[model samples]
Target: MAAVRTNGERTVNRLAIVSVLIITMIFLAPIYWIASTAFKPRNLATTIPPTIVFTPEISPFVKLFTKRSQLRAPPSQEEYEAAPWWERLVFDGGEKVVRSGRGEVQLSGYPSRFMNSLIVAITSTVLAVGMGTFTAYGFSRFKVKGEDDLLFFILSTRMLPPVVVAIPMFLMYRAVGLNDTHLGLIILYTAFNLSFAVWLMKGFIDEIPKEYEEAALVDGYTRMQAFFKIVLPEAATGIAATAVFCFITAWNEYAFALIMTNRRAQTAPPFIPSQVGSGLPDWTVIASGTLLFLLPVAIFTFLLRNHLLRGMSFGAIRK
Candidate 1:
């Protein structure tokens, strides 16, 4: 009887492992395709069978870096001499025609867009998490009137279709003369991400024992000090997970970014779509860009998988 039960458990464990592997592949397949496409030549990217593997070409990366270096170099007398022709045709032609002693590829406009995204995402994540953490602490520690109702209201804000809010936000930014500014987009992202950050952090904070904070207080620490010195350290895992979530949400945000800023502050998502010319987009460029975007998120999640799992579980018991 014991042997029969042991065999049954082993079979169940094997089935569970197989199921997990299948689900993981399903989630990772698109990312794999994106990374694969990035390295492929433009011609090979669109093949019918869809090439799953290839040796990476360095041209795309070379093109990306070379362009960036040129953008940073100071203008020269020769560059000034061509100003008229440069003005007539635009800097686009001037940069290509005018060359330094050594040959270098011009930096693509995509990197500037990438920089804009990085700035907006990092700033938004920091602000959102900072505000959300304190708010979550308040909700967890101090019982306020209709707290559950308030929490529901906060969560419901996230449900409001981004499209619905976008038009008004666009108009507001235009009115304030912030339409294309990084600050404008940072504020928008913070507002959009705040609800999830607050809710997630609140769950984690609630699970922590109040006794720890009380002990700190008894030892002469003020409430604020106790929070920073005691509770915050224990909640480090949850905060890290929350920061990643906030960063990714801001990084991948497109609709608002597209409408809010044009050339000056465009992000990768809009930039990717714009690469499409006439009939077909440059598949290789698109693939490469997609891979670049996914790589950071993948590395981050993999490094913090254990903490992420615990944070996401919100202290739920598996057994």
Candidate 2:
């Protein structure tokens, strides 16, 4: 009977592993496709039937630095032979001009766009997470009238999709001179990220025993003093976790950024689509740009993963 039970448990564990692997692949497929597409040359990028296995080329990677246009037709054999060594690898202009016949082609602005996203995301995370800590603490510790209603109202903001408010918000931002500004995006992202942040922090604060703060009060610490020295330390894990979510939300936000900012304030999200030229969008450049964009966020998440894990575990624990 014991052997039968052990075999059954092993079977269950194997099934769980299989299920997790399937789900992981489902989530990662698009990311893998994007990375793959980013490495292909223009011709093979959007090929019909989708080339799952094909020769890899360096042309797409080269275009990451310079803007290049598509040709009316493939280059002739003689043109391919006469091409400069570097051009052969990237443009291979051949018969048709590899570059746009129009005026000067400029280098891509991905670096600046990446910086814009990084700055706005970090700023917004700080604002949102800081405000969340205060609001959650207030809700958990202090008595206030209509508290449930206030909490519900806060949560309601997240239910209405950002698309619904983009146009109205755009007009409002323009009138207020907040459009196309880093500060503007920071404030907007903070507002959008606040709902979840507040609730998350509130839960973490609630998990901490009130007795800890009460003891601090008896020892002559004021309510605020007790909060800072006692409650805040125990809640570090939760704060770190909430910060990760806030950062990720602000990092990936697109609708508001696209409608509300341009030029000086534009972020990586909107600028990625702009990489494609007048013709069919170059999958390679777009892919390469996207890969570059994915790296910073990945690095950030990696750095904070330990704190995130602790917070998650603590949040799951209950009295």
Candidate 3:
């Protein structure tokens, strides 16, 4: 009987492992496809059977960052041999890099658009999370008038899809001459994320003991000092989790970014798809842009993975 029980346990464990592996593969497949396509040569990107294996090329990434035009004619043998490796990749793809008169390469808009995404996403995330932490600390540690009602009101903002407000928001942004500025998107994302940040942070703050702050006060620390010294440290896990969520929201934001900003402050989310030129769209370039776009959020989350794990389970159990 004991031997049979052990066998059953082993069977269950094996099944669990198999289930997890299957789920992981399912989730990772599209990401793998994108990464693979990003390195595929241009002609192989959209093949009927989907080429899974090929000689990887960095040309797509190069083309993604450079302005290029169709080659009028094949490069002379000397020209081909003399060109730099990246320029050779472009030349092989039947396109020539657009160059300035002084012989400098003219870059595409992707790099600036990528930078705009970083600036807006990172800045707004910080603002939202910072402001939310303070507001949440107040709610968690102090008595406020109509606290429940106020909390409900704050959460209400998230109940509606933000895109629903796109039209009015666009009009307002235009009226203020903020239609294509980084600050405008920053403010919008910060506001959109604030309610969520506050609520999430409040939970984490509530989990912390007020006794720590009281002890700090007894030690001659002011409320601000106690908050910075005691409460903030205890709530670090929650803050990391909230920051990740807020950053991703701001990073992947599309409709608002599309309508709110044009050339000056356009983010990667809106700019990547618009890379389709006059001919058949270059899927390789698009894929490369998308793969690069995925990196910042992935890295941010990976760095905070420990905190995120703890944050998710932080308040789930009580002594």
Candidate 4:
């Protein structure tokens, strides 16, 4: 009986390992493909049997720089046709060139879109995290009538589909002369992120002992002082996690961003797809831009991974 049970346990452990390996590979496949494509030459990028490994090429980087100059010069129809395939691939008049295998690559849209995304994400995160921290503190400390119900209602707002409110928001923004503006997008992202921040922070704040704040108060620290000096320090892990979540959501947000902003303030998400024109999308450029776009999120997550794990493991351990 004992031998049979041991064999069964070993079999279960083997199955678990196999399951994890399969799931990990499934999740990593897209990232591997993107990284592979980013370094591949344009001709090899779309090749059959899918080029998994190749020598790094700098031609894509070179073309990215030169394509804009070529685009500005009006090519005669005959001259355009006579131009090298790479040049023709890169420049398509006013249409956005998604990818180019020719002369030098143009990168105007990517840089601008990246900057816009950074501005929106950073501003929104700061506003959401700052405001949510204070609001969460209030909810954690005060026992107002219907406070639980109020908290539930606040969380419910996040559950409502963003698309449902998008039209109303668009109309409201237009009425206030805020449409297609940086402030408009920032405000929208902040509001959306605020609900999650408040809820997550409130839970973290609640986990902190009240005695710490009481002791600080008895020692002459004001309520605000106690909060900043005691409670906030203890909750740093949760706050870091919340801030990362807020920033990522704001950074990757697309539907609202697409509907809200045009050429001047568009972000990386919408910008990438919109660049594809009458021909093949610029695979190399897109791959390069995607790799760049994902870099910050990857760094942020990696840096705060421990804090994120602790935050999510809330209430699982006593001490």
lDDT computed for candidate 2: 0.79
TM-scores across all candidates?
0.78, 0.77, 0.90, 0.81
lDDT of 3 by residue, 28-55 (tens): 9999999999999989998999899899
lDDT of 4 at 63: 50
Local distance difference test, each candidate: 0.76, 0.79, 0.88, 0.79
Compared with the true structure, model 4 gives a TM-score of 0.81
Candidate 4, residues 85-192, lDDT tens digits: the string is 656645443322334667344566667788999999999999999999999999989977899798778777777777887899999998998888889999999998
Best by lDDT: 3
Winner by lDDT between candidate 4 and candidate 3: 3
> Candidate 2 at residue 180, lDDT?
95
Clashing pairs in 4: 63-104, 63-105, 64-104, 64-105, 64-106, 67-104, 86-102, 98-282, 99-282
When 1 and 4 are scored with TM-score, the better candidate is: 4
Pairs that clash in candidate 3: none
Worst lDDT 10-window in candidate 1: 86-95
Model 3 ranges with Cα > 4 A deviation:
1-9, 277-279, 304-319
